[model samples]
Target: MSLPLMPKATAVWLVENTSLTFEQIADFCGMHALEIQAIADGEVAIGITGLNPIAKSQLTPEEIQRCEADPDTRLKLRPAESHLTRARKGARYTPVSKRNDRPDGIAWLLKNHPEISDAQICKLMGTTRPTIQAIRDKSHWNSANIKPRNPVTLGLCSEADLEKALAVSQPRSSSIFLVRASEASALSQPAAPADTGHYGRTEPQDAHSEAESLFRRPASPAPAESGTETDPDDSADF
Candidate 1:
């Protein structure tokens, strides 16, 4: 969807002139609903001039009314007559004044969006892989001074570029999470018990004959001839 030239101003105008819900106004302006409420409460954007979308041909009066009648409906930006193509992306130069702040921006991206690739961060911040690696390993010369701050806040990258990189990395992060979950679940299950035989060794099961065991008992020795001494002639056949 096309955003207004001035989102905050447009939000202000919508808050003042229309009965549209905060969500509807925020959706149209590409801003948070809380921000729209702040504008209404005079807490933010105190002196900014409101730009009327109707005058800019960015909205039609009828469309506004249609949305005003139904709170669920969202206001749409009118398409421009000549659609301009987006400029091709290329390596960007960081201004010297903001170049020292790149490490801080890199730190923030590393901490907040680990799923995003170092290459993506490099492209977004006009930085290099080595710079990113230093931050990641806490080996940068200014590591102690590097406080994490948003790349956008540092004027190192645009929100759109950061959002696009995160979107690309989302699927990869999800797949990794799923794989880890499966491994954890497998480890949590109890192991099957092993069967042991007579000698404390795993033995194959077989049919046992209980009758054979009962019949194989050794016979008792005959009672010794008591006091029937035949002394020296004991060797003679009796």
Candidate 2:
């Protein structure tokens, strides 16, 4: 579930402004009931300002009233606004500690993924074209000390954002290389030979019968012809 922007502050507001029990507020804020009780007892968040979830469109007044009426029920956060209709915003903010590491991330992107465009780098790293160019040319103020590092490892950009940027910034040459590699792989394999019905010890039935008949012995001559054509060589004794 999407949470209110400042949960502790919202808990403080609920505790100070409403009579809802600690459990309800804790459930809504994703905090422990004992922690809410500590806030109620003035043991935690001593001087923090409370943020109104209702004012921020993160909660509804009617939902708050229903939860106030029933102590056992949990509070639900309002549904998020659709990004499809939401207007695009400016560049994201980088923390003070991580600002110096931008050059390292930029240099890494330039070296490793030169196909990525400068605009994509800017959007992903919260940097500008000049900074990217300076880093690429080794002309930045800290170029000497800057070492290429992953923006994700440095906490400068998310993996999702990096993937999205890569999708948008992929060079045409890389695609051409992929296509050529696939074609080469396809051409290297030999084609399979066609299947023939003839296999081991197999032939037409008519041809097999004709071949067997050719090997048959000839029939002996009749005994009557022996008496008319007897010769001295044919008799057993002369």
Top candidate on TM-score is 1
TM-score of predicted structure 2: 0.37
Relative to the true structure, candidate 1 has a C-alpha RMSD (angstroms) of 11.4
RMSD to the hidden true structure, all candidates: 11.4, 15.3
Candidate achieving the largest lDDT? 1
Which ranges of candidate 1 are over 4 A from the true structure? 1-90, 192-238
In order, what lDDT does every prediction score?
0.82, 0.81
Cα error, residue 204 of model 1, in Å, equals 10
In model 1, where is the ten-residue run with the lowest total lDDT? 204-213
1-238 in candidate 1: lDDT tens per residue? 7797568877888898889999999999999989888899999999766777786667889999999899999887887763333545787789999999889989988999898887778777888898889899999998889989877656676555677889999998899899999999999999976777687876544435445555677889998987776666767756
Q: CA lDDT of 150 in candidate 1?
A: 71
Per residue, candidate 2 scores C-alpha lDDT tens digits across 36-143 of 999999999997668777766678889899999999887888776521123237897899999988888889899998878887788888899999999988888888
